[model samples]
Target: MSTAPLVAVPAAAAAVPRHVAIIMDGNGRWAKQRHLPRFAGHKAGVDAVRRVTRAARALGIEALTLYAFSSENWRRPEEEVADLMGLLRIFIRGDIDELVRENVRLRVIGDHSRLAPDLVAMVDAAVARTAANTGPILAIALNYGAQAELAAAARRLAERLAPHEIDEAAIEAELDTRDLPPLDLLIRTSGEHRLSNFLLWQAAYAELLFVDTLWPDFDAEALGAAVAAFGRRQRRYGGL
Candidate 1:
């Protein structure tokens, strides 16, 4: 019930977004194309995550939010869900040192109440381990849904105040991403042009970029291209 306001970080000079979010889509499709199990693509997508993180940091992005798993993702086969959870465990354990070494702070945004106890522990550990880092914030959206986030924020606001006190800023302050910068650019891969329930509230003024590259195939070059494209557009925010 902390009423702390979210601080907004302005983008660095020369057109780089202060915050960039990516819908890491096409893991299963990438696997299908390779004649491999979907898990293989998910595993490979981890490499892409690493690459993109590095690229964003090099590009001076202050925050990078990655859509790792959505709330609807649980509807996937039980085995697939288990596999994804296993991957989460592995990534947290295997990558924390590297993230710390690179001075990256790990932040997980979602309704983690449903997550398994062990997975939650690992997530908490990762956050704690990187809590001191001052580098780029790496936000992994797991079990996250935009509608759910908004609903939760609304509920929190309602409980904490009377109707007269609730406002856009109040709701935003209750959001999971309230600690991070406002989203500036959101990229979706695998030819998807939709938000897919990722950061809907935070991306109100963000530039959307869609690419055909699969999640696993996304690399530094692809990331650079997306940023370059973003640089070419004018964001008027509903005004001329």
Candidate 2:
């Protein structure tokens, strides 16, 4: 019962980003342009998530991180936030089987303390189900903010490690992306040029790409183009 698309490009064929993060933006704008409700654009954006995920795996990306819901998004209208959460639920329910079949693992970053009890449970269960899969990783950031993550890491490490043992290494180990590969390429759709507090620490050396295409219209071709751009960049990491 899987409907995943086929990918013909092998990972070895190009310099694909091993760890790619995308800020899925412009859902509301995409809807507004079409004279439809914002929820429709979000629903279409979910389809883009599916397509990009498949493309990421096919291109041999080790991990794909998506900016799903941010902490600041809670300030939106109550009905809109609820609809977005509902779409997330539908996405997981519809795509879990396809992900499992493709041997891809699912992970959700960010704190779940404020989420509904049942929704948190569902996320936990999905992560558990995909934990043992030995394939590409799909990370979704829900209610995540880089500043909050850094603050939490600092607090946790301060309590766990003595001041003498605390350093950049200790803090990095406690970050949300500690286990994932260093971010290589960061992308934002809808012509956005800012990070918007997504992954400040991890993106220290990442190549950023901003595209005019809306999230709902982003497909494998757009993703591949971004990767190509990343491949052309020279990352010095402050070295000669």
Which segments of candidate 1 are over 4 A away from where they belong?
1-12
- lDDT tens digits, residues 1-240, model 2? 435455545344557788999999999999999999999999999999989998887678899999999999999999999999899888888888788888888988899657888788888888888999999999999999999999999899888788899988888899888889889999999998999999999998999899999999998888878887877788889998
**Reference-based TM-score of each model:** 0.93, 0.95
| Model 2, runs deviating above 4 Å | 1-14
Strongest candidate by lDDT: 2
What is the Cα-based TM-score of model 1? 0.93
lDDT of each residue in 113-191, candidate 1, tens digit only: 5889988888998999999999999999989999999998888888879999998899889999999998889999999
Q: TM-score of predicted model 2?
A: 0.95
How accurate locally, in lDDT, is each candidate?
A: 0.87, 0.89
Question: What is candidate 1's CA lDDT for residue 164?
Answer: 94
Q: Model 2: how large is the Cα RMSD against the reference?
A: 1.6
